[model samples]
Target: MHDLEGVDRGVNPQKTSVSALALQLEELLVSSDRRGMAQVRQLWTPGYLHTAAELFVRHCQRVVIVSGFPVGETYETDGPAGAIALLQGVKDCGGQARLVGFTPYIDRLRNCVAGLPQLNQRDLLALDRSGDVCEQLQGYMAGFAPTLLIFVAVPGQAADGCYYNPRFEDISDRTLPWEKLLELADCYSIAIADSGNHLGMGRVADPLARLSIVPAVSWTDGLVIADIANWGACGLLALASAFVRKNLLRNLHLTPLLEVLSRSGIVDSVTGMATASEDGLPAFSGEAVVTTLRNAAQTLQSGF
Candidate 1:
């Protein structure tokens, strides 16, 4: 309600402090200057995160969260934890939310759910990791009737029509065709990614070529890029909770859920070993990011 619209990167910071905080939040989330990701900075709309929260809170009633990127026998540790937080945020907004992924992610979500029952194991949906899932996906769409689709660290096919990990290794045989699934729903889509390897980077693929990885062929209605996928998801949660007047971060069990994820045979994208770290950053790193986001959200909501 701070009249954030039409404000040019917080032109009137004195009165539009909420917009200022939200704009600052946006800048913080996409500050990863490494890997030449800054090339797409031009495409990212100013105050778009707050705008997205408004759209989601006002329009979305049913949602499906797509995540999980497996490496070898290990799943990517980034997606599950963030997916859980997003699921909670969605439910807080009075939307029915479900998280869909491969067996590894579903397993971790289930394990984490034993301690965090708020996630509800029944909301976890699994798709075959290396098989054709067209029928399965269609059944899920028909059953859930989600109004929005969210991709968290899920990889997208490259221009060569193959899916690759950050290492540029083809993981097509191990990953799901997630882009096709979101297209099938024909609903609102948001992508949270760190690099061009993830789904929906196609929105800024050309500019991302400087990052080295071939940009994804899939595009989404909205995209949020953090140096790490989990951090971006937390940033999104902060904006959403502020708009809805709910403290969605209070119940965020990021640490415990991440502990469960570490034990779930998922390797870090950087270390290539199973640990609580994400891409080699320590586990507590996510905690710091989440805390920062929570504080920002409080500042905006308190109108300080």
Candidate 2:
């Protein structure tokens, strides 16, 4: 019998909901800017990242960065690079940050299990084996004691032949379930920042069940899902900056940041902009992308 009574009480065995509350508190403390607003609508919809980031930054002192399913071979070329980039951006702006690679053993185990029948016990076992990465990651965190942890899911090419594999989905979400990480980190008082996969990850089957799990995971910081349709890198940077700015201002008033961004018409530019493609995706020019990144960097520095 699944113990859902715990959920009604606003807590999970992993304490996911309580952690989400912490995230909510943080957002309430910060002032919202235009970019922040756009990010809020795009990423969180009814729920918001600014609120979460505010609480996480206010409470945590160290951050651990994790990337999901990086395309291509190991370290130098995978999804982790994006996670590394964000950490570097934070470090460059004078924030404490560290990079942790998910264990390689998990990948090897995956290859060995790929020959099994679809959704067989062997397949499930193989996916379960990937949880070892989480265990190793937890051990590393215990020693480092970071205040915050950021997980980025790297985007891969749509043309890549590796599509429609349910096993990959199971490996990504279940083996290293975010809720489990939140439970482990909560013990250390570390906050979580997650940029879930670019495309909606397994939402159609049970949307509420998926979303419900999110609240159980402690996300005191930002939750960014890159807008794949339009803007791409530009959208991601803009969202990240907005999240950081809102968090930094939790202790202070938000009016000044709002005034500057508003007066400069950055908000209008972002909102009035048309989708870059017929699919309603955003397209950004090279210079525009650079400017957005720079703006995000500045936001991190200014504590907007």
Off by over 4 Å in 1: 1-16, 32-34, 42-44, 129-132, 302-304
Provide the lDDT at 48 for model 1: 61
lDDT of 2 at 230: 18
Instruction: List where candidate 2 sits over 4 angstroms from the true fold.
Output: 1-47, 70-81, 104-135, 154-179, 187-222, 228-287, 296-304
lDDT of 1 by residue, 159-224 (tens): 889999877888887778888777579688888887888998888766786677867878888887
Measured against the true structure, the TM-scores of the candidates, in listed sequence, are: 0.88, 0.42
Residues 1-304 of candidate 2 have per-residue lDDT tens digits of 1122322233111333423433332232111211232233334343333443443445335655543442223211122223333444454335656544344523432332333221112211112444475776577658666666554442211223222111233234222444344456753222222222222232221222333222122332344332221122222333344445532212211222222222322122223322121112122222232343344334453442
Instruction: Output the worst ten-in-a-row residue range by lDDT, candidate 1.
Output: 1-10
Q: Scored by CA lDDT, what does every candidate get?
A: 0.74, 0.33
Cα deviation at 181, candidate 1, in Å, is 2.1
Which candidate wins on lDDT?
A: 1
